[model samples]
Target: MRADVGRVAEALVEALPQPYGRWSIAVFDDPTPNAFALPGGKIGVHAGMLAVVRTPDQLAAVIAHEIGHVLADHSNERLTQELAVQGGLMLVDLFADEPGIRRLAVVASSRDIDV
Candidate 1:
């Protein structure tokens, strides 16, 4: 299993332009059909995913997709967005005691709005 993953990963890495991170792939014992790639080139594949993918090419495609996410920095971008949201919520909480602000927050919350 490791050999097959390595072969496909090598091919994909070779096709990319120079200066990608140092990659490492690990097979997890989990039953969920999932795989993920982290920043700095850590790839994880669950045993269930290996069972579901019928061929080497399919596995390569999955791995390549995860690698694309890492290369694009989607995780960091998502974290930044979440943090901004949390900060906004904190500001709302801090100002919740003021009459006008409290009224607005009450209305917003009644309407299922976080702000």
Candidate 2:
């Protein structure tokens, strides 16, 4: 991650409300044209996104969109909904023992569902 990107992330986090201290951001070196924010305020931006985003505002738009989902508690809702629909309440506790569950949740939630 570039120092400037890190600074931008820090600034964005500072501008957020309430659970500000829980947030973190990272820039991945991959060239995949993607970015995502995980639950608990983890954000990841891909190198390809940086290359194509064109301006700080555009980049901010991408980051802000991800942050919006986090702020909206979409993942938690999705998890709960998925559990109910799948009748996976018995397996819900598995998330506590599975790091992969959290990672998958973040990735799934970060996807642009509207697209």
Query: Can you write out model 2's per-residue Cα lDDT over 22-79, one digit (the tens) per residue?
Result: 7777889998988876788888888888888877777777888888878887777767
lDDT score at residue 89, model 2, on the 0-100 scale: 33
TM-score of 1: 0.71
Q: Candidate 1 overall Cα lDDT vs. reference?
A: 0.77
Mind giving the per-residue lDDT tens digits that candidate 1 earns over 12-99? 8888887686888888999999998778988899998998998998999899888887788766865776566567667877866566
| Best-matching candidate per TM-score | 1
Query: Model 1 misses residue 81 by how many Å?
Result: 1.8
Q: What's the CA RMSD of model 1 in angstroms?
A: 7.7
Best by lDDT: 1
The runs of at least 3 residues in candidate 2 whose Cα sits more than 4 Å from the true structure, single-residue gaps closed, are 84-115
- Lowest lDDT block of 10, candidate 2: 106-115
C-alpha lDDT values of all predictions:
0.77, 0.72
RMSD per model, one decimal: 7.7, 8.0
